[model samples]
Target chain A: MTASSFAFEPWANTHQQRIEQVLSGVLPTDELLPERLHSAMRYAVLGGGKRVRALLCYAAAKLVGTDIIAADTPAAAVELIHAFSLVHDDMPCMDNDDLRRGKPSCHKQFDDATALLVGDALQSLAFEQIAASQAPQALIQVQVLAQATGSRGMCGGQSIDLQSTGQHLSLAALETMHQYKTGALIRAATMLGAYSAASTDHALLMTLDQYSRNMGLAFQVVDDILDATADTQTLGKTAGKDQAQDKSTYVSLLGITEARTLVRKLHDDTMQLLSSYDQAADPLRGIASFICERSF
Target chain B: MTASSFAFEPWANTHQQRIEQVLSGVLPTDELLPERLHSAMRYAVLGGGKRVRALLCYAAAKLVGTDIIAADTPAAAVELIHAFSLVHDDMPCMDNDDLRRGKPSCHKQFDDATALLVGDALQSLAFEQIAASQAPQALIQVQVLAQATGSRGMCGGQSIDLQSTGQHLSLAALETMHQYKTGALIRAATMLGAYSAASTDHALLMTLDQYSRNMGLAFQVVDDILDATADTQTLGKTAGKDQAQDKSTYVSLLGITEARTLVRKLHDDTMQLLSSYDQAADPLRGIASFICERSF
Candidate 1:
């Protein structure tokens, strides 16, 4: 297929709907036991985001010649984790933020304690769902997901970010932080998708790891770019939050021009890794461009 | 073996040592990339409780003709989840306790944010360890553990508990709260031990679950009795905390004599369930008696 033939808007929208449905199906209903916690869990997950992680999961499934159905549970698992992290990070003791994705944060919408339980329960639910997958390597997939979200992965990233608050960090240090914090899960999302096809090829896994690393970092770089340039309404989150919180970001470390330049380089590197695949990898390429170029 | 031949003092001590060693081996060292998070995790898990959960795991393993070695990883995994829950529950927004296991709470020892990360990271690490288990039934073990720890299990219990704070609870409501909050994980600990041996016998699993629930409720009933009758120094935690917090308990709702009777009755029921097993279940019987009758 030619480059001009590839389209991402329709692809992303379709994946988002499917992902939302998958989440709704798996989450505990409010009519059942512990309705408030269930309600908050649903509230945190439903009615938001571009479902970029799910899209990546689907796109990676395509990379291995599988359909989106194969990626459904893993995709939802990754998003549940992402949503849980957001709920915790927005707590008053953490980021002290009141808004997330243009609405009240979980703690604000619910209560502090409910929000805390929401994160804890959601994390367990994600593992529970993934472990229930019929994929042959289900145990291995659980390990992969767990490792990415563990202390050496996402939680570790957030720890350093908290410790490094109000302190200037070198570019190497910042990269390491984001690598553990955000990049860990993004890479897991893509790898989980790739593994959802139950393929055991080590070489493809390595290539996908490289592809995911580049893509994950590129995603963050673009986010920093948007933070500096986009408005709150466009971003759907507090724009320029990094500057206000005195946290280091790509735009702050490097000027806007250099930050934008880094995004392009990472974007090219991501595409280069995906080029080994046929046009079936088009969604992967499309998402790379989409995430990097989106105004919000 | 005769009942008189069984002893819990040596058995529990040996299992505690073994569980501690496994925990140290699995937890990330503070020398690693995320030193603070690793440190907090270690601090939260090591040098902890009576290892009742680990003992239950080993006893359950014994029921299925497996030794403590077969039970090591699962035992440590349960303890880790237990430890993480305590850390989060001790935060200012939750129970706001200052001490756990006779030491400063995680938030007091570290900071609020570090405590949060410790809980988050420990939960992930627990899954990582269990998923790495070589047991034939590892996936189901994960599910059982996840469900026990999920919203409808531990977290759900905690949510209703937070909502019930300062409100009068009926005897049934209090029992329901403890069933989900404390009983769920206790039952999981025993079941994971059963599942650890990869046993497919439904009847035996059902028996063990019944034994666990009885033992779990009895354990809490004993706790409430102690809270009402013991001192902080002996309990290693604040005594009369529930009463002070306006939280209802078995002792608060049922009076001391009735609560004690309930504890004895539950203990009898637990023993009756274990009677169906051979002398191989002596350790289970011993632990149940010890939990219900221990001065501490």
Candidate 2:
């Protein structure tokens, strides 16, 4: 809308605002019983972050020729899962980070136990989002989301990433790790949109999986590059902490320029896949480029 | 059946073995990728507990004339949720317990990150278990479980327990705490059984809820009593840790003798509720008594 290099900004902004409203409306307020846990859930989730998963979900739904409402529930669920994972990952025994999205991490603002419950409860809320939806394929949607986020996918990737920290990781190993960790959920977001459709286009969903995997890897590569080079204020987190902590990252292994090229290459691959579709795929193409290009 | 005081032992033993088989068959083993996380998940779950939740689920289903297969899915799902919560609660930032089920805790056996992922993936798998089931009430089953375990229920209780540590808790406060923390899942265990039926009897479910609430409270009171009096070897965990951590318990506030009477009263209330049901309710009545009376 503002005539930036990206064409998807206005559309993404609309979806972001809509998703935030949905999340706000759905989440129980802190004023209720179990006030502390509810407050922490809201605090952890409502704290600002890029709603990349939601945007992707909306885009995928549009490409599949489905109602936006069909996409909303799964999108919200994916975002909650993301938020919960962040809360757990930032705890004292894990990343131990005190800052997230320019705000105190959940474990910092709330105590560890409260933060732990926040994450746990948010995860249940995520699944409830899908279950509560009136979508025809709601059960399949739950299965897809569950498989993507579970141990063999995102969780498995996290295990590999944790093990690979400070170890000499080959490029192939890094790709596999990101594929499971970030790529799996990103892939799930896209599949959720497709599954939300009354009748999914199997061929198109397969292609979208490719787009998602590439986009997910591109996202992580950009993250590592930003972590290596950006300032804390620019990144809204403690930048360079990965390098400081001796974690092996794309930037650390291949340098920033090469990582940037990889991002562009992945972007081109995603866009090329989108080129075959009609105008409905524009949102996805725009989002693919925007996510790889955006600062946050 | 053995000549034990509980007639459910024959039935309970059957369900327990079946549940163990289901769990063992379903969990991704250590031989697969991300071996440590998988191993820790199995170690934490397969390590051994009384399988009280599974027994309750099966008993509830039997009362409503549902197939055992209908109960197995939810039974395994609830147990997985139980196991996941335990892994996270045992982390250093939470209860800081070192021993669980006579073995090192998840985080102690594996690194913290692996343990965290294990809990997360287990939760996903739990939802997946329910979603993958062919049961007719699969959606309601998920909702029942998600509501029971989420912020307003089990996680909420944990937050209160964390907050109440070292504080002088009123008896009502203590009841509310246990009702949420432990009672919710145990309650879910029963509700899930009721939901798993093809056509649920709402009145019976309502009665079962009362039975579950009283049984859940009685279970917790016995737990507190055992914590104060049982040895760690018998309990398969660090006994008396509650008092060591200054957490309030029924035994702590009421003294062991009074707490025992409360247990008996709750037990009588639960048995009375079961007595009104048909002959099919025998397993539930027997298990309720066994859960209240078992030393472990």
Candidate 3:
């Protein structure tokens, strides 16, 4: 089904409120931190946006029989990482966008220094929160999250993206970049949720890894399509900004039709993988669908 | 013994070589990673700095019964964190300095974007190296290192530093800034080393913590002194840059004489705490002295 056909309006409405409540409690309050840093963090995180990563963490945890309360740390952890990336991406040296989530980007609203510090602070806070969790497996989960977000993962991907500007990239090169930059943490989110429940099925973990890889790429492919087709207002940021910057995207590398087809194939593969699990995997299925169908 | 009399030259020389060697190996040459990212990570980390933090880690671990080779990950981790901080701190929005370690800062030598990515990459690499270590206690040590370097630690301190610039900070506020900015990782270095060796003594850890706190402030106090007394060539980076920017420092707040007295007091206190340990703690004592005596 197309994004328009899904009608997640009511579900999204409830999810947004749940995410807001969790974030407000999870994040250190202004009284506990520098007001400027706290405000910048809240600005990027609490501002209206799809809590896709958080949902993935919660869904994966629930699938593994972990309660939603137990999912809060990982959910907040991924969201913090997401917020940090956005803040840094919007810096003048990177995407240089003035806006994000329909509001002024961190660097634009505050000074670049504040924005940089905010990103740095949020990044550290993510790890701190994860490490400080009372969950029995919190340390292991935190370590996993760190690896997914660190050098061999997301940040490394960003480094590749920065250097890849104006350079021709093979499909393999593009995939490598996305795998490191975006896919790693997305995959880690699911893995973390499973690990949170102390799930120890090696076969299931491998299957989930494969499913996450497909979903991660599918997520990026859809993002590329939306960037090309969506309006700025609809996207809540500058649409086609990637094209404007001449950054290579899946849709640019392959035509929009091919990109869409690839996502469809990826979605199908992911669905097939999920079928091996029971009905408890419904949230994982829903998330994959949501990712494929997101409007912005 | 006085720092001038202690002779840290050999330690400095050996530690420098060790840090470079460890850094060179940490970033895998595997074709899986983008060449540009590998290059940026190398540029940001290799062949830079005095390796003070790395030396501290190695020394502390050695003191606690771990071999220097076994201490490599924590050593590399702290140095990488230091390198990342330097890279970002030199950005136009932060200290805006053009020179670092007597060479062009990363943002100046490479483009600002490359420098930013380099910093980001190095930060991730720090954790990656720690997490990937083969040490028996790798997981726990890595978690400790991450917490110390992240928010509520180094990054938090950086935010406070930026906020406190040009403001009249009280002695306690200044100490808090130093604790977060420089102290967190310094303390972590010692703790990581001890943790790596599986030292579970609560009293010993507390003593090391106290030693680290005093040494951390003493190091910063001496830094302020060196900035005032040393030249640019000798100090490596721009000397007196802090004073030039009207940043609040212990010397600025308490005068050089009082700052000197404070360092002496901290040094004595650190030594007293360590005295409870045996001669195996000589390196720790040496490090504490080295913090006070380093001309630069």
Candidate 4:
């Protein structure tokens, strides 16, 4: 099938289910030792989020002709990192959101201390999953994910955000923040997925990375758009939180119209970047389009 | 030198300086982007602690005839995990201590959010260091460290500690908690160190682990003793905070005399466990004795 003829829904749904299964298999059960921490970790990760990172991973793996099963570990690892970030970001000292994925935040459902440990445990579990993988490049996967998750990546972005709260940011500064905060992991997901295929070349990795960079930015711009326009019920999180906290976002810096324009550009760039590849890259294109067009 | 003749103080001082140097090199400086987070990470990890975990790792590596330079990565990695745990545990929601290693805690020195990010980033950095290692068994090291740090290990033990606060725990239950919390990582340190040696045998790993298990519990038993008997000036932390929090500790459960007795027993067991090994195990014995006899 051609890229345009590819059915994105089935692919997305299948990978989502696959990632959920893998995550469930890897995560400690409530029946395990330290039942409360295990339970809260499950509560935070098992039933929520769009699993977009996992989807990106699977799609990138498919581009390199990797079996869907081969993508499971990295996909699950990236998603765990995502879930841990959300849990910690919602804590009182951070964003302080009570709602996440239409449920009480981890700290709200469990106590703050349990939530803290849950996040910490999940972060380690993510690396553990990668380390335990049978893949030859598992160590590389760990390094990529770790670099993306640590100071120079997601955490760095959040720190910049925290420092910039209640202050205005230039367009460059805003993009820099989101690039580290969201874009780093988004790129990591695709990089990890692509790496799963042993035959994947350096050029393929670079192209996939560029595509993910644009897609990652598009994802954030769309998030800013939805956060400004959608209600809490529709968003499954505390909407307008950025504005409420006086946090500078795409919408705040460039207005909704300009934010939408940026998403369109990023979406176009992402699709064009993948155009050289065959139908195997269709899922990535579809996901990019979805990022640009999704309402909530 | 024979085990009995080993000069632990000078050896420890040298290794301590070595780990600090490695940590300083690995940690991002304040000059890096997201300057504050990098600064806080450096602050949280550098110039602090006994470096007991790194020492254990180096000693274990020595026992396997691994070069000290080869042990650097895993040694730094385990210590990074230790430092990260301290930063998080000292947060307001967990132990809520204002002091760590005789200085203001990370959260106190740089705000709670920075401290939280510092811990999270440090954990990732630890895994990154292991993943980036040139060691062939680096993946195994990652798995070992991640398992020891996750829900079934340090975090689990902390969760149990949080839940057991203000409630008495049986000596068995308390030992189980310490096994996970402290013993797991201590065991991991030796495992990682031993694994750095290409020829380290399973038998060697198992024996070293048993030694670390006793050494770890003895370390905590000593901690409890110090908390009960030493002043803030000596301990360099908030002495009596455990009692103030109504937390269950060895001193609280077994009393000072019994706690000291447990340390002595653990120390004896540790030394006996190493009796089969030659003088290369001297550092391990030295550390065990220090853990047993330390007033701070």
Candidate 5:
């Protein structure tokens, strides 16, 4: 089937609205921060984007029959991590991108100094919000978020990406980088949703973890493909910028056709794992399909 | 007693050594991180000053009769926060000092980009280490550390300080900035130490909080004095840098004599608060005295 034949099911617009509300609620309201830092943070986070992390979290919680509101901390936490990464990634020393999500990057719209602090503040805020959360599962959720975003996770992945630039890497090296950088938090998003439901079944947690691993890798493979195929207008940011930087990507290493095939295989594998559960797993099934098929 | 006549007790050499050992143990092995990021982190963290924060954690834990080994996470966590702050504060947009603790600041030693990531990675690692800690008291310790280092704590204080630069700030505003910026972590150190000993008494925590608050401000007042009076060699970096930047400082705002008087009052008040705790609180007592009398 052609890509256009797949109907893009946007999962839970309500979840995105709720996450935006919570993010606005938790950010610093004090007047002490200059308008610049505040603006940079809001620009990075509140700017419209596909809130896929929050959606994944909400979808997973729903799959386990939990109230989606219970997933607020995890939802907000993932977005904060994502926002922080973007702020830093756009700095002149990193990707040096002048635009993001159809607007100026944090460092471009604001000064680099303000962008740096905004990233730092948002990151600290993410953990603080989780720790201060009143949810019954606050402590466990905080632990999950911290581990997923810290060294051996997101930051570790960034480190690998930074060092691997301009060098050829083995598939294993690339996968390891993605696992730490992207897969860790994606997996945490699913696990957080399950834990938000207060699920205690070890078996179910294990299966969701495996499903998340496949889906996370598949998500990155599709990202590489879109970078190759999408336009600036469609992608909402500069496309093919990755190639401009000579950075190694799944498409660069494996070719577009192979990357697409791998994503399909991973998508099928994830679906097979989710099949173990009954109707309670419907949301998970929907999210997996949405992730593979979504544009931009 | 005259400031010169007051005998200053040094940190217990063994306690200092133990903290050093713990810090070395918890940092990512050189092999795991990119050489640039890892080297910068090591240079910033191990390029030590007094290790006062770690000592405070160890001393507080000891006062409550908790094993020093159990204090490792809090000790490492506080140092990480301290290190990250120094790295950012030394950047071009902030205090902009090229040297820190008698060595080149991370940004000066490496490139600014690497320094930024080092600070970022260290901050993440701090939280990661606390969450992954195996100590029985890990959960409470993590909560305390997270709150202390987050917004409404250190980050918030920094935001205020940044905004207050070159602007005339009231004595109360100045106090508020120092309280948030420096006091939050200092208080966290004491609380972490107390909590490390498994003493969860609200009243005791309150008393230590009061003690730490006073001591933290007093420490900053002394820092202001040193900036005005000491030479670069003695101060181990640029002296009078604050006045040069026209940054709001206790000594600059209140004059040297008034700043000295405030430090003395804060020191006395801190000691009076700690009098109820007995010999176990000796480390705190010594630290309070040291704050008012230190030459640099």
Candidate 6:
């Protein structure tokens, strides 16, 4: 497909459905033993969210000329990690939000204990998905996923977020927190997809990583903008939560107009990083545009 | 070392220290950024417990004649999983206990949010440890640990336990709960260790697994006995909390005498499973005996 003709909307929609199906097949069926936990796991994961991580993974894999099928496991695995993080973050002890993706959060849909187990099991299932892959790169993939999810990455970012609640954070500190909490997994998504190829040069990996960083931060900036300006219905989650909880965010640090300006810069940087590649890079470029421009 | 000449006491002590060292080195230091979370992760894992899982892993690796060094990652990984489970299981939403390993549980030591993140981070760290292994079996090792930890394994068992609370369960049901809640990880410890070898036959894996099953059940029975008979000091946690919470246990169902009798039978069966192996299996034999006979 030519770069000009390649469309992000159809590609994203197709893969969103694709990952939902893959995740549905991978999660334990609700009919099995521990039926409640199984049901809650499926409930937490199998439904609604933008599969941004999975799309990024597939785009990066395609850019590296690997069979896109090789991207499936990492794509699904990153989505599982994302799902688990959201489930835990919504618990009473954390963000204490009641709405998520237009449904009651996992803890509200199930009990707190079940939600806890759902998050734990989903995390394990993510690794299980990655480990099931037969590629020679699978070992490194596990390492990458784990590193992104662990104390120094997503969880660490979360710790800072929890601590910073009700307290203002400097712009640098906020960015650092976002780097660990969200950027780590976002970067891993792209890196994992690229690694699906037989050989990915260090330079290419670094370029994709820089692009992913820009996109990850931009994604969060847009989220802050939406939380500030969108209604709960449009956001599919409680709006104005960051302000209500006194949590620091991009829009809080910089006004809405500034946050929008920052997103544009990030989008431009993301595009520049992919300029060396051909039409296969179109999906990534398209994703960057979508992230910065989307209303919710 | 010849099986007859090997001494369980010294072997156990030496390996226990080795694992403690390995875990300490692997866990992020408390002095780092997000220091509290890192500190909590270290506190939840290091300087406590018998390292029973690690010992089982090393023993099984010894039996299979792999370079014992190859066993370290899996050994530490299993212990990390065990620590994470305990941390979460102690939460008010779950077990609601304040004491664990004789110290305040993770939630009590830190706040509930930190405790939750500690559990999540440690679980990720466990996979990271396994992924860091250079062995060809590392991919399978990740799969084994994830399967043992997820819905079909430890978390699934915990889910059953949560659902069964304050309700009497049949002997078969209770056994099934313990099998998933505890048996799966114990079995994984041995299996992971065995997998460290260059090649392990399916039959040998089954034999080791059977042996592990007997040991795992016996370990839980002994735990129930200790919970009933031992002091908080001896057990290093709240004593009799199971009965206080109206949770079902082998001791609760079988009476002390019958439970003791079951332990004896399980110990004997474990020994029989190891009969074909010579002295290299002595550690496994010793561990099984310890599980059934220890007072606390």
Instruction: Please give each candidate's TM-score.
Output: 0.98, 0.95, 0.92, 0.98, 0.92, 0.97
What would the DockQ be for model 1?
0.86
> lDDT tens digits, residues A119-158, model 2?
8899899888788885888898888888888888888888
Return whichever of 3 and 4 wins on DockQ.
4
Q: What's model 4's TM-score?
A: 0.98
Highest DockQ scorer:
4
A-chain TM-score, model 3: 0.93
Model 5, residue A277: C-alpha shift (Å): 1.5
- Runs in model 3 deviating more than 4 A are A1-16, A134-140, B1-12, B30-32, B134-140
The share of true interface contacts that also appear in candidate 3 amounts to 0.47
Every candidate's fraction of true contacts kept comes to: 0.86, 0.77, 0.47, 0.87, 0.28, 0.75
Quote the positional error of residue A214 for candidate 2 in Å.
2.0
TM-score preference between candidates 1 and 2, better one? 1
- Candidate 6 per-residue C-alpha lDDT over A1-296 given as tens digits, one digit per residue, 9 for 90 to 100: 33577888999999899889888988989999899999999999978988899999999998888997888888999999999999999999988888999999999999999999999999999999889887768888888989999988999999988888889999999999999999999999998998888778888888888988998899889988998999999989989888898889999889888889899888877777777888989989888988888843
Q: Which of 3 and 5 is the better model by lDDT?
A: 3
Q: For model 1, what is the error of residue B287's alpha carbon versus the real structure, in angstroms, after optimal superposition?
A: 0.9
Report, to 2 decimal places, the DockQ of model 4.
Answer: 0.89
Q: Which stretches of candidate 6 lie over 4 Å from their true place?
A: A1-3, B1-5
TM-score of chain B of each: 0.97, 0.95, 0.92, 0.97, 0.92, 0.96
Model 5: share of true interface contacts reproduced: 0.28
Tell me the interface RMSD of model 6, in angstroms: 0.6
Alpha carbon lDDT at B38, candidate 4 = 96
Cα lDDT tens digits, model 3, B82-147, are 888888999998999998888888888877877776676677667656655656666666567766
Q: Ten consecutive residues with minimal summed lDDT in candidate 3 chain A? A: A1-10
Q: Cα miss at A170, model 2 (Å)? A: 1.8
